[model samples]
Target: METSQTHENSIKLTSTEDGIHLDGSILWLDSKHTGDISFLSNPQSATSKLDSRVIATEETIRILESFRKKPKALICQYNRPFAIGPLNMELLPSGVGLGGASLWVETNNKKILYAPQLQPQNSETCHHMQVRKADILILSAKTPYNADANISRKREKERLIETIKKMVSANERPQIFCEPYATGPEITKILSEEGINVAVHPNLFRILKVYEAYGSHVGSYIQHSIHRGDYDTLLKPIPQNKQLRRVFPKNPVISIEDNQGPRLDDGLFRKIDERFYIPSSCDGRELKTIVPKIKPREIYIFGPYAKDYVRQLRSLAPVVKALFPRHLPSLF
Candidate 1:
């Protein structure tokens, strides 16, 4: 057996789980001085009234710490090679192929969704799960904030409604969408109409700076014209089949995010064989980048309202909303 300890930070370690003292120093210490920068949602408050409440637990420490390290790109694997000393620390689930299963615990008082990623909430089924009424939705803001395509985060956007405002139950805890900043007024208005208390808080203070730099709205648009069955106007610019071009309803705004705030090039709408490509421009001269790096063959053509990519895809094929598996009625 090897050894591990957390003395002056500068962590030290070993392999054997034995030969090491299992006193106050090394109970769950699977590793040496390894540490994480993380936090958990407040437990089911004693004052709140609900049947079941979910509070983030020990995993919170690791999840946050992993993020504090500013991971390069998010992945949805359970067994990466990161060393965790000896605590047997398993990284929190990114909720990718796991389907609709979430990483957070919830109480009846609130529909708490511990979304590992902080991308826009757009899943209709996942949003519908909030039918039970949610008081809070604690989102992991850093999850897919700087995400790349062909990963779990990309899939979640397809599976879950990308609209952050509707992530929580429209009935539960007044519906709080916690991220790095505030929720859009349009979203707040919807929740208000449903009598759900709703607000968006920064999942981490570090994220707040980003929102401040941008507009208060960190997320893009909610109503994707392409997804919403409006392809006529959105498709006028495609160089492809002209028949496809006449199919869309010309819209001044490509989508909500495009209209309300700065967003990734709207041209990014198709998923072709293992990659997500979008029409991107480097220094005003636009080009299609394979998500991070545009491909040479990609025609960086801007569509109506500057959305050539999405319009082209919509002009060619119809994109559908993802169906989130509904929560089973509780045993209670």
Candidate 2:
């Protein structure tokens, strides 16, 4: 076993660089070019109640506008390695979203895997699980309380199905709230197969259409048009091999919720009140299962967790809590 002296020093946060650690020192990972730059959603839920309650401030709008002005294309061609500064970056598909990726970085004879939310429960390829020989592995965790990551996706799916089936049997029209950007399509696919019609939010519908237009697998079972239009225009019947079905008469032909305030169920009809929300966030247990395989020299924990939980994780490998604000720019 290695001691603290052998382990890499703590990652430092700096203003100039986005948080990345290099040569055992914190440095910025540049996003201006393709080298050492990749995309992963922040650990926080993009669509949460608090977010729903508040409108974007001017600063928020400006920040978002800045991103739109200079958007970097993150290549998601699986298993293909691209150069990222000092690292040879490979984008691996994480099943959590339409095209979300788990970045595997290789540089200077070291393998560093950065997966703030690497989920492998539903994937047959199990790319996240395939990660081996990582010198430093970065993971996202559900804090305060440990994540029940031990629960398999199959089990989660089974549980969800059973719950929905029971609700349907009881004549309850359940509305499954899903993250617009990420897991909506996945959940929709599962529900549709069970002959349950899903009323998708417009945001999610648009994302699915983009995937479908590009012929992505996530959009295969998700029947929707890529044409940009309002709710009524999108709902209007269009010719397709897979005919769309209506969830309710008043709600129109193809199932879609209108863009309105984020009341959890924005456009969903009142009858569809029973909510079956899907929590697609990363679980802490993911690391417990992964650490033994990669056997990394160091591990960085991102996201929230209780102090005791962090202490317990010490036995796993050299552990460090990645405090985003404090440890701003870390490169490895």
TM per model?
0.18, 0.60
Local distance difference test values of all predictions, in order: 0.23, 0.44
RMSD of 1: 21.8
- Model 2 per-residue lDDT tens digits across residues 1-332: 11111244433322122333343421223212223332433212222211111111122222222333323334336676667456576656555444455567776677777655555555321123345468777664434334343445566666776776776576555444444444555666666567665555545556556545444444223234445222111112111222223345333221222111122422333343333323454455555675677787766654435233456566777664443333332221
Candidate with maximal lDDT: 2
Error of 1 at 249 (Å): 39
